[model samples]
Target: MSPASDPNARSLVQAGFSSDPPVSNPVALRAYRLARLRAELRARDYAGLLVTDPINIRYATGTSNMQVWALHNAVRYAFVPTEGPVVLFDFHGGLHLSAGIETVAEVRPALSWFYFIAGAQAPERAALWAREIADLLRAEGGGNRRLAVDKCEPLGVDALRREGVEIRDGQEVCERARAIKSPDEVIAMRRSVAVAEEGMAKMQAVLTPGMTENELWSHLHQVNIARGGEWIETRLLASGRRSNPWFQECSDKPIAAGELVSFDTDLIGPDGLCADISRSFLCGQVTATVEQKRLYGLAREQIEANIALLRPGLRFAELAERSWRLPETCRPNRYSVIAHGVGLCDEYPHCGYVEDNDRGGGYDGVFSAGMTICMESYIGEEGGDEGVKLEEQLLITETGVERLSRFPYEEVLMPSRWL
Candidate 1:
């Protein structure tokens, strides 16, 4: 049978449908996120909020791939107490015209019936916007209104301060709302993982001895794109002696008969959900130094153990501890943390570490039903002659976790005859 018709074909084409059905409008989901932000602002006694981060902006208004830096010319969004329609200020002429097509925001152009002014120059323009923002807050009881600002690049914050606007950081509030995933978000994430698994399976079939690392890298990239991936977030292919953590990207190095080839690829769907997976393969035949059977068994056992421990109310610190202990029990030299939360970013809510900062810092938060996480674990010896890395994405549920990618995790050693 042709590879496409072969039941065991590794490429995504054989896995299932290549096309995805249309997803519902992310507007309702975004509104829920905004509600969380509003509650935070109200608790802090803030009058209005000025959101500037692109990701945060997208999270709030469902607007993606637009000029997020046009603060002075456009009023992206301003939220007032209790009232629903947010005040929008857009300085970009094109934004006003394309508002209907691009974003889901209640847009307010600078030329609207509301009080407005445009400066003669760029610096003056920014100053004017800052002044208008302060004035809006003042009109809405600015004395008691605390203003929350997101992505206040130092220079912009300085300008706002000069305009006499009181600004407080909103990073924590935003991250809190984004940390938990919704049902829709989980659906999108599952699709992203499916696309990634498809790409991996395809790469596995064609990977062979004598193929340069760069060639294999290209094949992975092509498969990901063909599967509707918006971008290949990351592509790392290392072979032979270069399969260490520090080693990244594909070089001209040829795959030796018995060497191991390890790859890490990240795929992102149009909805902005991401899936990250890493796998290792043996070319030709098994050799000394690295026992393929032993390492693969260790990796599988470690991954299974880690998955079994995933549940609601489990502390991230506890997860890290369990991950480290697996290496000692199964085989030595396993990774520190085998998994983490996946969403808009690859490392969001960085789990499995003892660090007190980043997303994993607060172990107090319980694992809820909608969160999608990636579970990864690898086994390698000191000599670095060979190793095995296996990874998969999972969805945390009310009761337990469900594996999103079911691809085989066993060690694969393509024979020379096939190559």
Candidate 2:
């Protein structure tokens, strides 16, 4: 059946809210993000941020070229002070790559020790990089003698320490900055959700028995790329027995008729926001078994109940306390986390089970306005090799939350007893 003709699909589409004109405005989006970061740094008394994490660098400077390469080799980095210029230490000789990015003040070579160490002569380059960073920190007002480095090589950190700079964990600053979503960030995320749901709709339209899990998985990548998304972070698509306990990466196994298929979209879209969503599907025209229906229903119950309880000012600890308890049969294989904050990727404020949260950092903080949260649940019977996984992305507002995911659930898999 065509997606539009399916009642479940129609209902989901109708319930999703989108604006008349697209909410993506690149200029405004970048400004909002940088402003938020600066605010966070100011609040934390950080002199300047030395961001080397590819994702964190992209967050600060808006340049994503050679991202994966920078992860292994610290070739690219960004330094932004609370008040002054934004600098891009461009590696791979890609200085021109940051040409028109408004937030960037200047681009310079990121000649790290790693860049020269293969030929030896490492200390020379490390000193140069350290001197450059020391100067940047001094300019940002070295009263604190502190700089936050998100991710960096040991050579670079040692060099900075020798220069008398106290290095702090920059990821903490970046996470606190990104914990809340600006209006434009929310829009970019919503746009990503729309693109992913379109991919889901396409996959649902043509699902059939005998289709390989790889084939089903390709549909999402193809659709997401065509819609301008970047990449899928994980191989989270599986079918039949593979879908059971979850986290089985997509394989060459062929799907059998009347079996469950589950997938998680760890998709990083064009706007650079990650759309981390999951849904379970029952293969074509098959009647779901009683066990299948029960598992799916329980996951839905858990998700819906938690979503209802979410509101601004609700304590994360209280929410964890109130989370649905998994039945004894399902507790052994229950997913570790109930929810986590989502932004550039699976970020801070991970809300674990009461037992897990009670350890020390129990209840990170109160849910505040403008935070984006992903509620997650996996329901698999301990001994059974089949299960269901459900997740939804939400934007917390002054009053309550808005569902950013609009993909329809599998009606056939849902228990009929549920209204």
Candidate 3:
């Protein structure tokens, strides 16, 4: 968004709302997200939501601190009631981290009751934690005892239950709330994708034979940190034979010429948005083998054909039924989903294959405008020595889908004629 359009953008920078570039209007973004979360709660008859998952906390408060550590530590949380103040429970000495943010109504010291903090006293401390939560609910709940918690340990759950609190699966509500993106969130996502593409461009520019996969993947990490990005979710860069089955981590094995180097940019880029695009590049300046080009071509075809099926109001089941048909030989190693929702990170509404029903996997939901998703394609024969991974992030718009990831495909391996 234009800085001139948002009068508060400049002031927010000076106020330390964020140290990175202002990619979106922070005020509107936070307000929209909070409202959305509340609506999701009200829809489910929930009195409030207790957010302990670090990612959910970020979504609720727009403040981040040691997220990876807190993922397991349980030392931070937020409480957003359907009709009351949005309270943030921050770690000790961390209240200043969200000082001037407008989404948070109050910042209080968090109560840590994890084993690391309380050990054998964990159960005792947990009772204290439960009392505080129960008191807040009694004050803010208007007598509604149902609460949705995105994440909590068994101890916390049991304690809350004993306090007459009905615990609901809060992660489901959070996912539904996060599936839709506001205009500012889309703008932020675009900027994140741009940062990822810049790093991919650098990787391609410097790619050479004999360079280890670790060396090549470091370029993405360096670019992400150097830019305003947060982190890369995986080390999914692999070369040649290692790329065949997919999901291989980057190793010290040196890449060879003519081999396909496939990678998925599971990047948490600038603005903490995820840029999840995948591409395969031919290593060095050499002609790709016919097999390499064939794999790349099939993957691209699958991406295009499946993307063509996306539109607002489409049923997930129908989309999965009509998705590009994987060849018989490649069926065993197909990607987990035809597509899946992507926002803060890879998230809900996993669009799996229609045949996944036997595995007890199927959910009915209609694709709505403002939902950003990543469509994935991976092609390789069961015993092939190489594979190609291709994916694209797109926005489901009122009219149709808008491709968000614009990183160039491997021209050398792409067929002259492509859809």
For each candidate in turn, the TM-score is 0.77, 0.93, 0.94
lDDT of 2 by residue, 1-419 (tens): 43446654442256453322276777887887788888888887888889988889888877887665666877788888877899888876688998999999899987767744434668777878888888888887557777888987787789899988889888888998888887888888987887777777767766789989999888888878887888888989888788767788999999898989988888887677888899999887878898899999999999998999999998888888888888989877888788889988888778888776666534558899999999999999887879898999999999899888877677888887565
In candidate 1, position 348 carries an lDDT of: 45
Clashes of each: 10, 0, 0
Lowest lDDT 10-residue stretch of candidate 1: 111-120
RMSD of each: 6.1, 2.7, 6.4
- C-alpha lDDT of candidate 2 relative to the true structure: 0.82
Q: In angstroms, how far off is 356's CA in candidate 3?
A: 2.0
Worst 10 residues of 2 by lDDT: 12-21
- lDDT for every model? 0.62, 0.82, 0.87
| Candidate 1 segments exceeding 4 Å error | 1-8, 11-22, 43-45, 66-98, 101-103, 106-129, 132-144, 284-290, 324-338, 354-364, 411-419
What's the C-alpha lDDT at position 113 in model 2? 76
TM-score of 2: 0.93
Clashing pairs in 2: none
lDDT of 1: 0.62
Which numbered prediction scores highest in lDDT against the true structure? 3
